[model samples]
Target: MTITFRRMTPDDASAVTAFLTANRFPFHVNPAPCESSANKRVAEGHFWSKESQGYWVQHGGKDIGLAVLEDLEDDNPVFDLRLAESHRGRGLGVDVVRALCRLAFTELPQIVRFEGQTREDNIAMRKTFLRAGFVKEAHYRQAWPTADGTRLASVAYAILRSDWENNTVTPLEFDDLLLDA
Candidate 1:
């Protein structure tokens, strides 16, 4: 169950293109993506930029997923993760997320927190966030738009660097809306 992360490079274009095209990420607004589009996006460095970097989620010496970590300059960095279709539903999300947390907390020393978001309908991902020690920070209604123009609520989660290092969960205070009599 060895899991590792590899920084993606231009040489990985074909492999990334194939991996993204072959899988259907139903939880995303655009579940089915065309191969050519995927290739073009990868070639265009959609995932790799000055503010962001993409990585290959390798398990047991094989690439099984992709993770794009963004918002590098901010105190809070976020990530987008997608596992291969065959690798989904096998309890790998938590492991991958934990690895992401390690990369964020260690590689980016200035970051105070690491964040991730998923559609409200994506219960699996939400659970994975919880399992990986991310606290539910927000739920924005009608925030995530779909391919057909419909919208779903977007749920946000985060893990503090302190919490990650200490192996603790520091719950957010959500009672700010209480009205005084």
Candidate 2:
């Protein structure tokens, strides 16, 4: 399935919360912060750094997932993305992330690099990030705190504008880098 991201609205709070509640993330369990909480945190406020813009993914006109991103204290972009169970594993993850990165780089003037973090055991996510040109940069032992207070190892990945630009600029006729079914 093909997916795309659209701007998020305060009205999307319920849907975002519902998606998070029904989804099972390996190292996370906090319910989507209360609607009012997310609304307030994601909403514009002087204390909250900067508000995030969320995009609900759609495939063939049906909502299938969400991707949320924002700039934080160090002028770095942080993001979270999820694909519905039925939408995972057919290569849609890379497509969604690319779209998000493109939008982020285009709209955010100060952003030169974009970053994301995921549990080390999340192989699929790591692969998707790599294939989309993000290089795994750091590994933190037991960084992901679980519901039981157990911590899971976490890894962070990043891609800079120059990295993506240089890689894509090279014109290679051979298809070694291409994915095949």
Candidate 3:
């Protein structure tokens, strides 16, 4: 809980590198050198590369996980996320996802929607997405190769700006607008 979002810089690489290394699964860390370089390039602008832009998950000032949002103009921008093993399964993941959604909707007006996809076997992440109000949209069977040489299915979840409309959260309308046409 109590997460914060901050811009990424070259200064964050060491902290981010250490945060990413604790991953128990190999899926989190992408091994291309260009990935880091590309993020550095994006740091000059408001946008950041999915690899290096470093939107982190911190608990008690320690970097327990890492997340990155990229392709800001896409109908559904891509975000990569990973949490350290010790921090998993404590409901913080959903909390983090909700916080990220608030940021995306508030900061990026062009982002009509936000979406994420994960291997179907990654149930924890899938649950987190659902808890954050992202509805399951599609499942692609045998679309990805797993670490065990078996194919995996990918599932997409999304929530639109229209979906954020709160029927009860806002004060109820009591005027001509509330009357039938």
For residues 1-181, write the lDDT of model 3, one tens digit per residue: 4876776666776555455443464443242224454445445542344322457677778767767776765757767677777887777888788877887788778777777788887888888877788777778898767756777788887777667544112222334356568
Clashing pairs in 2: none
Q: What are the lDDT figures for the candidates, one per model? A: 0.91, 0.71, 0.67
Off by over 4 Å in 3: 26-47, 50-52, 165-181
List all candidate RMSDs to the true structure: 1.3, 8.2, 8.5
RMSD of 2: 8.2
Look at candidate 3 and tell me the lDDT of residue 2: 80
User: Ten residues in a row with the worst lDDT in model 2?
Assistant: 41-50
Please name the candidate that would achieve the greatest lDDT relative to the true structure: 1
Which regions of candidate 2 deviate over 4 angstroms? 27-49, 72-74, 168-181
By lDDT, the better pick of 1 and 3 is 1
Candidate 3: residue 57 lDDT (0-100): 71
State in Å the error of residue 160, model 1. 0.4
